[model samples]
Target chain A: MSPSRRHSDPQPTLATVAERAGVSRQTVSNALNNPELLREDTLAKVRAVIAELGYTPNRAARQLRTRSSHMIGLRFEEAQEGTSNATMDRFVHTLVEATARTGHHIVLFAGDPDDPLDGYDELLRATAVDAFVITDTYAGTPAADLLSRVGAPYVTFGRPWDDPSARHPWVDVAGAHGARLATEHLLEVGHARVAWLGWEAASRIGEDRRAGWEAAMAAAGTSTDGLGVRITDNVDAARMAAHELLEDPTVTAFACASDTLGIGVLHALAERGLRPGVDVGVVGFDDSLGAQVTWPGLTSVRQPLEQVAIEIVDLLHTVLSHKTVTEPARMLEPTLVVRRSTLRDSAR
Target chain B: MSPSRRHSDPQPTLATVAERAGVSRQTVSNALNNPELLREDTLAKVRAVIAELGYTPNRAARQLRTRSSHMIGLRFEEAQEGTSNATMDRFVHTLVEATARTGHHIVLFAGDPDDPLDGYDELLRATAVDAFVITDTYAGTPAADLLSRVGAPYVTFGRPWDDPSARHPWVDVAGAHGARLATEHLLEVGHARVAWLGWEAASRIGEDRRAGWEAAMAAAGTSTDGLGVRITDNVDAARMAAHELLEDPTVTAFACASDTLGIGVLHALAERGLRPGVDVGVVGFDDSLGAQVTWPGLTSVRQPLEQVAIEIVDLLHTVLSHKTVTEPARMLEPTLVVRRSTLRDSAR
Candidate 1:
């Protein structure tokens, strides 16, 4: 049962493939990397030999010879807001899968968030990663500038909000669209007094989500005059704020900025002995893992993590291939997942 | 504000440090790697110049010269059980921090769960990582064997239960000890009919946790006969099994194998209109991020992830330095965190 006792077979090298195919070293190389240069019959013969021998290309050797590692660099930042951080985890999972699907692998690294460029510099000097995919870009972030200064190929998963005209490639989710979907869903379910719960910060992402909520409420022709609007991202703080909101008795539902705040709304309801779906409808953004198993299943907005990963990889590959990205900044839509938290009559 | 329009300074190289320190390139290199060869004043002067010049060593060039990458490889497997997988995430976070503190970095990769060595092979050939820190190893697992056959240095973050005598370095958390703590806590809080919720599998980890609960019950002189010991790791599946357990009405508390299973217990109690802390108490193993946010915060066993991360890095470094590891397989203790979920009279 212990295979450690046996001698291991050496991995098949280019020489082995060349010897098996009865081709010169250059001919085998052409067949593997520059197949179009060879005749159809020769290409077909070399391909058959490679398949029969089960020879895999050596990426490190190729990188050494060509100065390009088929690896993408990703920096895993420490979770600052620890409670609701699944969105980044989901992004990473899809990024790894998507990168692997395209004959590339991700090199995960952690850097000092305060001075992230130091980590990037070290990785660039030590490894053969061809490009990088930067996540969680914010206003005045130095990652894009550092990558540009060093002439390293990279793509950010967040927009360059500090400077829209900056020459960098990025992809971001439309948070405003996600917030509107949540607000509209609550309104459609006959909630007249829909209060907004948002983060108390001058964040671009936070502003986008709040704008969506305001627009949806205005379009519904409802006077949100007495609606309770609490500003704080902490769940406990949101719960405390909700206590005051519940005193009015006119607030029927809450449209939260994220699932973390939505959880707080549920806590407030439980405190007052108010049923979630029956007495109050709560909707949240970023359909995190917490929403799935919550007592009364949360209704939330789900970002297309898979598609976002694919787009980021595709865009990075474009830049690596020396092709201009037509639309440097791409925005994707978020979908709504309706659950028992909003479905009052459906007894599931 | 417009960094894109301004010119940036180039990263400092070894030559820059050497020039600043009024020393030769070889002297600078010796100062950084082998300070004992130089006088104390010379060594201090070189380091001061290096800090001032911001000269970071080139990792790739050093690997080519020395055949060491100073990196530890880690493979991230997709969560098969899906829900309640925060334990692995916490491990990753801590691992990154610990590796960085030792002037080393981690390389994250993904692989097929059924066949993991393929990913390791690919990474070994493509990068210059010195050693690997393997997590989530199981009985009859081939990762250790495959790595051994290739003569690759690695240390697992789990015990080698299938063969305790296997020549390998590992660091593991005492799962049975954690479970025992949880069970003892429940018993101390006046819970006589405390049932156990566990996964329905022959997992070494699962068995370890089960043994702790059994040992605790035996010590208390309580007959655990007909105790609701449902075996399903899935949250919804556990909830279904919990319905039958709750029918007995005498089961006042539960000691779950994991936080994921504990979440299911919470769901089951909510279904029966029973308050978590008031009517019944629930304790979970692995104080995961989910435990902190769940309503009535789950009481759980907190694994020392930071210490575990530190031990793994320290052990791998020892192996890389060709030093003898005193204890090949080290096991660490776990602490129990009491929260509102287990407290009957704590009003939030």
Candidate 2:
């Protein structure tokens, strides 16, 4: 036979296999769908017919009938000018593991350049992913507006400033709660004069952390004025701030907002002939890799990054699959990791 | 008008526009291809007619006539079990930037797991991408078999071991050259007896580095038999090896294959009241982020990760576009970064 003629042979469809196996169409469908329900003989006969006639289920046809791609988009917003924070990298790694378990793949896309107005419109228009997971929200970001306009399923890593109604699913560690825990640890240890070294006040996370510090001081009946609060853009600035803070002997301890700031604080203290945990106690937030490698290991608050990643993936899957999500907003508590940085001499 | 009737309208094609604008088909194509060639009046007239008739080019029909997808696939082996390395992360970041400049997007995929024997069969059967880029090669890997079976145009991040004559395009740093430079640096600094601390010897890069170390020692009139060569599965083993090497005062310096191993040596030496630069010297390969953060920062070799990333993308693009690649295999040289770890004193 000619190659074209041989290729034109009639292949058996599901109905043909059902007829040949001496069963109804519903019975054949049930055998394929729920094999445990059918008798062993019946299943064997159907499967034999299927193999003999080369009857293959058309996955493309099924996908067309059910408009589901089973793929999700992860929109990573690059740091405007500097490097991405370590927390974001950890989140991406965790998300990769979580998605692999469900037989789904993630496609990464970059967001629009940092602009107050345009936002993620360009990214949304170019990609046709079933869902989105956005990380690291900033104030005045157009993500919320674009999410509304696109009307696609999405989960955010942090709560937006304007929306307090919990309309969308979000997963965030209690930033204020963690900061309060750090401050209380220092205060309970017989340190009356404590300072706060943190990031700039532009970020929502920084503001929340600072608020927690203020609240803890107020609860102790201490004056908020002249409480050594040094804020800077990044680690280098924090180092300089720490240098200036050390000039004052009254500030006995410091509660830093992040681990990078804490490491910088330790380096600065060492430069001025002051030893951490001896002359002054230090506490930091976010128990990252930096916490382990610092000179006197950092005592900080540990945010559950893996748990957040798992819950975010679960939420996205539920939304995409039309399952009801019982909790719209989930807040995880951060725990304290005590190390040499905060160990008092008497306790040691 | 009904949608069906609207589709039946006699739309003006490119040929009609070319005729109406009194230009050749090539000229009209160039007007669309390179708009700067045509005068303002002529380009405006052509564009007006094209928009009025709602003419849209059928990219699919054009692709059928000329087979091209303008897409590339990036396949990676399972990530090694540990924290992500800085070199690989930086390489991926640079690859994304390089590919974006050429208006092509990279689709990242993992090898198939069900049929381990034919891992890339699923990807090969589905011809969605025009070319491929494979990273992180190992001996007897399914990727090597897949590349050979499919005969697809591709580029790799590392060289293959099984078949040196495979004639595949690749971009990698000169491993032996970097090792030789590192060994000579120690010798020039007046360190006579040096030991080698490394991981598995089965690795191609590992073997090359060992050869370089041996050659350097032999050329310096030093016996290679008594040289301390420690192979370990973990950093703890490396630390123990360092402790043993320090027992003999003859071994004055050490050469490590990775920065992590080098850090372990520093820690091991500190326990014995021997500082890195004062009592002994140390050198590490791959100037990763860990190298800079360590106390008395590590001195190591720095690979051009960004350059390799850009070159891989460029080679893949050229192969897919049927353009000639001037060089099939490219090797980049590594630079030495001197830090406090290898310096004789803090003053230096």
Candidate 3:
């Protein structure tokens, strides 16, 4: 379904409302903008005609010109001290930059973090957003189902977790590939018993990333027993888990599912007076601002968020142009940013 | 000037464009939506007239209906990890929520980090945004200067740092008061020689916050020799400065201008095997997400960002309605959130 398509009826203008209500164009204008100027009966009659004629006084004008609102709807997620907040924030900045080139701008709406459907429904009712860019599909994409049912144009930043064949254009970073790179680097640096501090198995992204660690460990002919730990993604939880895992002296490196977990490891090391990048190695995902600015600087797998944003905008343009998407999904590669946290040769 | 004010020339519509071009309404519509339907000469004639008549095909329709675009322009800052990023991010979320109630939405644009005036000029030229919500005015607000010259409406989140009698409406948090609260709390908790870790002297926010720490220390009749330090606002610089400051055993507490600097203190203490909130107390400003979720959570002075956002929106409505603002500057007080970093009662 083309996102820009609307009803074929001739759009009603101010003149049409004026003619239907048996009033001068000025009277109709006053009724719409400054109803206090009109007699009560005259205002009522003009308003009823506007309603009966299916004239949306404000949106009608936009529809008449472009057949679309050049605005793209995006839900600005809840503000929190979060690992992914920095990642999503940077991506949004790039998306804003990319959309500017096409004369389309992003309209950010606040929504309940637990309810992905909250802001989207309200935007659809109140605004003429031409399309939407959906994100945070880690649990599941109820947003995709809702948008598909409504025939609204949308592109997601994450792949549909449950269904690879979902009929939507999406751009996702290669999570499993990113984790594998981190594991390979740790192994190359002479850490055979590399641990994986990951999110709970239910998170699709966590599982995808963990799979890479598992594959890398198996390829290196290393036993994976007791080195894989699943926990909540917050710092305190990761810190406690990594602290306990550090008791095993053989586990000399960690490949983490998120920067939060990586930061947790740094804290755990600080408690024990262990020097990171020398005593042990760690790598985090998302390359968040938190990862870059933290003390000693966390080594992380940086998803190509800028490229993903550009690709998302390119897909938006395609759907808005009513062009068929030959390829429904685009996955970009993730690269590693080496910092002091993972440099084993501390002097180098 | 009222933000909604514009040139009084009658808005040109499709009918006007067609009449001037000696063509039918349908022909003009074709020239706009399907230019290939007309001969090259006719298309050129229609285009020339459309441009000359100032029929901003897409924007003119909106101008005709509301006389104001229901969009507010905001420049999304270059995403960075800092003490203020989370503060500004949360403020933006609240602003978006506040604008929604008034049938307005925020349009985010990206700009060069060093140039404050870049995106505003582009947004003014391209979009029909009714007004702008200027953030990051701590760097002297060149944007305010540009917007004032162009007669565009704008409200800054930060007060005019260099000018007390600036003309624009602004909503700013009470930085000095917040720091005073933090410093007083430290003194009340058995810390006499409290030290101040702040930004360089040139940063207006840094100086404002530092004044509070100085006031609190002096009010308690404490000497401040070798107890005040300033550096660039980053984790590494703060950490290094704090480490050197810690050589003085009498300076057992630190009140910092930012959470970034406060976290640096945590790092410095961790390296020295000193306990934060036990052997020493630490306090940060802005209560950023980094402060909230960091290990041994940082005690921080929290700006009333959500209330500030609401106030900014209210100011915007006043200007849009062409009302004279009797009071243009509104300052909200910041409160302190005590966490593990400042809790000397460890068992509690």
Candidate 4:
């Protein structure tokens, strides 16, 4: 029972491929890892022999030799258990796509709701994951300190707004700019006294989005007082909040923090027998799939998921390869997608 | 530059813990792997020493010694890129949770839509994933053949309907039973002529869902002739198809193969000013998160995703641990959740 044996016959090894190819073990290694160093004829012969032997570059043995696990760790954090969130799913999808293009594969760890960095220690101890890609950053995220203490190479998707001087590699979307675009678009569409609907939770990203709206309002010389900044994460809660906000007949539009909140705004408007885009304008963020299906089709700011995913992987890869990435905090812009939800007098 | 070094400090090993605990390396191994073999005091002492020394078990060394990667491979197959599927996300969530509890982690491979099993050989050769959890099974999935040829263990989420003689571990939802439940509920609600909206794709699960509707309709002593089974995977296509299906005023209800098709049916109904659960009743399968958000709230059959995920991990773990899982081809029943969409003249 050899380490690589399946049942009766042992799995092929580098030694087997070398022997079959009439080459030295070092030659076989070079053929796989540093093929350019070998002659064309020798490389071709080794590859064919390796293929014939069905030889797989043993990752365990390679890890021992190179001190790299070649595995990327990702934490799947659910805000609410058993509840589906589209943004997180999309992020995961893009991250998987990005990592797959590289040779590295993802090893997902379930983030402990209580500890936040729940599975980090266990993953670091039990698996050979080379680096981690952390998302859902908030104030006092224990993941950063823990990974830093362990000297684990990692990159975060959210900017570390809590610690401005932190030197860790991170990539974030320009959510504030996206919000500004949404607010300005609503204002341009002849909407005065636009309301801002945001999450009740105190998060850096949430603050950024709010700031964008505030800045846009201020620039327009509009009084920011009583702008109807209602806070709610649930659609129904947001809808109820929206109902209260809409009591002021002058508040003609809503700049929602997310598509979910926007959906709530739409529900509230429907309850009042008001049509979106025509009677009351609404704009959402994160252009999630739900945005497209929402009755009037919500106007939203699309997060550049693919680009952000690529940056996360590239930053982590650079750190793992011992190469310096100059821009540790890479901020990318988000695009605004205008749909019928924001158009004035739009058809159903 | 040792294999497990972090910056200037080398990570602690079993020998370090053993020396600190005043015991043999075997004692430390027993403390971690075979803890039950050790005396309580001895086990506690080794564990404390290991923790104090920050000693983590070297998985690569363990892999070389035990020949087990301790990884479960799962393919993230995308039917269409950027299309968020809640069922798959929930499945991944549950799988991660289940495996994390068992000290086994999942290694996700980006499924190739072109070849289906494009990354199979790559994963088998590059990583030490113990077994695969195969899902999204079609009539001729290349994954099964690829894994079998390589002597890899796998358990599928779909029934191996293409080959009944195939003796592979698999667990499938009784989709037909779910369809039966939905159909019977529709009939119970006084809908005489029910239509089935199914995917045009040739899938075992899809067929099972349609068959359930057919079977239920037959058992009711009603002729299923011209039952208006319109098939389309696209939402707009289904909507257009639904328009044609609804031309016959005799059709009083629709049992959809998926929530997407159900959504399309809802859209078509809305366009015609037909209130669901009042003028026409509608029921969807998979009871995805979308079902809850759809207007009037769609009545749908909930696929036991959590249970199914647990079963997948359990069956694969059983096979990997050399334990036989009795009733490998397990068929679990689905539950129908009645919502406003199914209630006649229901209000939001």
Candidate 5:
């Protein structure tokens, strides 16, 4: 009676497939797109019927009509420039897990922050992704120019340094706020001379974290002029710096920018016969797996990586759909996980 | 004279942009793709030329005619389901770093093992990629079916579970071999009551690792009748199991499937007032960040993830270019890294 039934071999449409498989259209779609969510037997039956009827959904036509590729593009600014093996591993894992929820996939494009605008142009012309999510943007990067030129819907993992007024949607952790919280925690516990072990001051994140430490010191009416602050990029440098700072004796607490540097600092402290909580309190950022696995586990600010990832995806989707976003930039609060690294046993 | 230079306003190609920017074509490409490799002024000039010309190269046409999309697809079997966040992150970071070396990008796709057939149709039907790399394939996954159907060249991270004769280009660390090596190390140290802490025994990797452990134990003339083996999926479960096994006073050494589980075992030993190297020797697989960060650092068999990733990409490139692979499947040797977890300072 239908166009498919009239043919010698009737091809099953969504309705026919649903009817034949004894499931709803939505169920059939779910079985095809996200089979993990469906029962094995139900999925098997639906697949068998679809294969038996040689039913092929016209994806191209559907994509064109809806303008939704069911695909997202992820642009990694750090990935191209050679990030540490650990950082890379965590990012990929988080990205895959986040996108799996939407039954969508990701296309990764890594570009140098120092490159001209051409890198953006190349990516734009290469794939037909519905939306884009950019990570780790630096000052005066070509990504900014490309993002503005293409006018493609996109979101960033970090704030752009060049333009605070840039109308791009972004999700970033309140680094300064978290650092201040860490500083305050140490002050409340009678640690007066709190030092700071951070990455290069040139990094925006480092600067923000430093600002928070200074603000906390100012609010507590403590003189920070004599407080130790060591800024370095390498773990070896941080270790050396920590050893030097510990020799001062007045430096009783340290707020580190990352867990990696914090670990190195811990090792250095241990070599000098200094206990973490009893001798010197330490607080690190990112609450990475290293934070938990370290001896006297690191008390650090946990960045909601999963939540940030989800929010970035959601923002990009909203922009792609031409919906109005309530906020151009959103900053999520970091939760300080009180682990053994900074807390005395009595405090816990 | 040329099609691009016909107008008074010449459209910038890589060559034109290079000439204007006073650099080589490769430099221009590098500047665009990898700015970190270049100086600041050169990058700025390249951007100026690109902006002035408003030049956009047709990537689709170039990809079609040259058979070079400059893009590769990364297929993961359980990436959408079963992998840990840490493992996933490392793989993604490794893949990104490995491919960036050749100026290629990665598109990630998750395949359903249950279907073992139509799961990869979406990736196949969409944009044409230069090559594909498959990771974490189960026994009955859709990878083989997709490979056969698409006719595109692909490399697998792990070997085929069934059909040892299956001639697919694969790059995997010899897990079983690593396990055997670990077991042999324990035996060489006069440890007779060595136990195995394994992942899910249902997996091909787990089975292979177990076989290696058995082979090594048997070679040392030890009976497998009462071997203490704990198989689990959760880290806490492995820790609890390790605690129970230690209570028996027979399990002297343990070789775990992963560093995560090994760390858990170490934590359990510590909880019972027993030091790992002094009371119970331990070895782990994957030699991940978890292994290094843990106290009395974990002794692990390193899988050479970077080497494997690079080799897989190289193999996929060759296969895509229609080159005959001299060796269809290559097995890499896993190296044992001895740390405080395995041997006391005096023992070493």
Candidate 6:
């Protein structure tokens, strides 16, 4: 599989066609596969450009020559038991849509959760998933090493946290930026002494998110002493930690690293008979289903997952066509969604 | 892509190897590709069987000759906006795991949500997804019809409700059986007038589930008149309907067709200052994240999604290997997960 990628990179055929047609690679694909999906004029324009470029619409011909599968392998990180903070489903949905237009499909498989590289090599050999798009940064480091060593074409949806020198194309959400927005939103709502409930120090993502709350508190001239708690990302553990934090009269709000942690704070508030937004404001990250449907709609930081998928596809164009690496990594900002949890009203 | 499936079906070489080797088809593939994952004795045994069966482990060679992709196409139904009743994610996780072991993968792409076949033809030609496994029974009719007409190999995860004459392999859960369990549980807990909150009459799955609650009520000899309300599956709509249902003091429990509706009932109860379990018992279908993580965990029907994935894979073996189909269609039962929503003492 890796050897197939080592062939002399093809000329910028699809990109040139797309640019000349003033449309996306996906649109060009749609013109070929589902022309009915496009307007008559758009379809005509795309077909004209495709014919002028001599871009072969037949993937079968390309496969015969280069063994190209036109499929990107993604190792699915299964949803954690009983948790709604899993973002893979949302990301995959958009990723599928983003790639489908370009006549590509995402090949989904489960690697041993305990071992990320467990079945990766076999998948490529057996399923012909010769290329990949990695999601879990922690596991992705090794995947990058293996793919790079083997010379396979691939991209990452997360930054290489442990490896500083790796130059593979990547995109990541600005975790600190999202957490800062969450913390700032809480402060704006008149909540003082907002505490941070986050994952343990070992997690780069957790620490990255925690930095935002710390920076915001420092900027606001608020005391951080005895106000922050770091634990494993679990509802029960975070809930117990939040219960202890709530014993202090001054802690009036929380900015959590993840929705699972945020839910724990809500659980603690429920136990203590404290209304979520009125008594103590709460904000979660990822804007997951739990945040959306929780009793007092939980305010959260929403990542631009759709945009992330689009960027990955665009990056694939560069990597596969061997185009100039204009941007090796992209850090997209996150937006805050305000709801009853941070609105100081509408709570039960 | 459809033309590729017209080749005469291959012999059951893999099945013979697996059975003689005292292993599964997955183990045979593992012996060929990722032998390190298996034990030394097991690998040796599988290799022996492969030799005796004269199986070709070289997919590259096979692909070159047959133009086979070994990729099963699936149209992703995106998660409903702000709803937790969506069950596609869980099903996909298991499907991917099940297929990976046998050197197969799911080619996930978004179809035009409006038209199930909107991008079907294009995806087949562009992605080389020569086979399929359909999930949405309603949209599946045309897909199955098209594939059968084209002589493509395919299986369905849902029953062919509108096409009983269809001979395609399928696996479906007993919706009525699941709903009956929910209603009877409420009855056993001293609730006589348990109501049914369900989808409108047009949905076959909805109607199937409704019959269970109806039968359970009749079996218990409880009057069900005015106790069943059908509407579109939405949280706010279901919540509004639940509010109206709550007006009748006799309606002490509700069995909903989906977790989204059950969450709605929870919202209505919160608004009326009524407790979920003590004042009103609520049960939802699918045991979705909403059911698991709601304020009072929702007691709901739990589909054997993992088992369904395994069944689909097993059916795939029979369909693709040209083996005699023992059971053209399989039906599995669902269980209930009891939680705080139905347990009176666990609520906040």
lDDT of 2: 0.66
Candidate 2: which docking quality band?
incorrect
How far is A13's C-alpha from truth in model 4 (Å)?
0.9
Chain A TM-score (model 6): 0.82
- In angstroms, the error of model 4 at B91 is 0.7
Query: What would the per-residue lDDT of candidate 6 be over residues B1-348, giving only the tens digit for each residue?
Result: 011111133423566779888899888877877899999999998887665544554444455455566778888877877788558888999999898777687888787777766555554544366578888885338877776764667888889988878898999999999999999999998889999999989888999999999999999998789999999888888889999988889889999999988888888987787878888999999988767777767899999999999999999978888787999899999999998788765434
Over the stretch A1-348, how does candidate 1's per-residue lDDT look in tens digits? 112222245656779878888888889899988999999998998888876765666554566567676678778765533365466677777788778777776776777667756467656754447788888675555877887876888999888877867878888899989989998999998888788888766677787788888889899998777663647676787688777788888788888887888888888988888888788999988777777767777889989988999999889888988888887778999999997789878455
Worst 10 residues of 3 chain A by lDDT: A1-10
Q: What share of the true interface contacts does each candidate keep?
A: 0.29, 0.01, 0.33, 0.42, 0.23, 0.44
- Indicate whether candidate 2 or candidate 5 has the larger DockQ: 5
Docking class of 4: acceptable
Candidate 3 residue lDDT tens string, A236-309: 88889988999999888999999889989987987777877888898989887677666667899998888999
Of the candidates shown, which would achieve the greatest TM-score relative to the real structure? Answer: 4
Report the lDDT tens digits of candidate 5 across residue range A193-289. 8888876657888888888989999999988875646566444566778888888888888888777677767767765767788778888787766
The prediction achieving the highest DockQ against the true structure is 4
* Top-scoring candidate (lDDT): 3
Deviation from truth (RMSD, Å), model 6:
9.9
Q: Once model 3 is optimally superposed onto the true structure by TM-score, how far is the C-alpha of residue B258 displaced, in angstroms?
A: 1.3
Residue-pair clashes, model 3: 0
Weakest 10 consecutive residues of candidate 5 chain B by summed lDDT: B76-85
- C-alpha RMSD (angstroms) for model 4: 3.4
* Local distance difference test, each candidate: 0.78, 0.66, 0.82, 0.80, 0.69, 0.81
Per-model root-mean-square deviation over C-alphas: 3.7, 7.3, 15.2, 3.4, 9.6, 9.9
Model 3 chain B, poorest ten-residue lDDT window? B1-10
Colliding pairs, model 1: A126-B60
Predicted complex 5: DockQ: 0.17
Candidate 5 chain A: worst-modelled 10 consecutive residues by lDDT: A1-10
Candidate 5 to native Cα RMSD, angstroms: 9.6
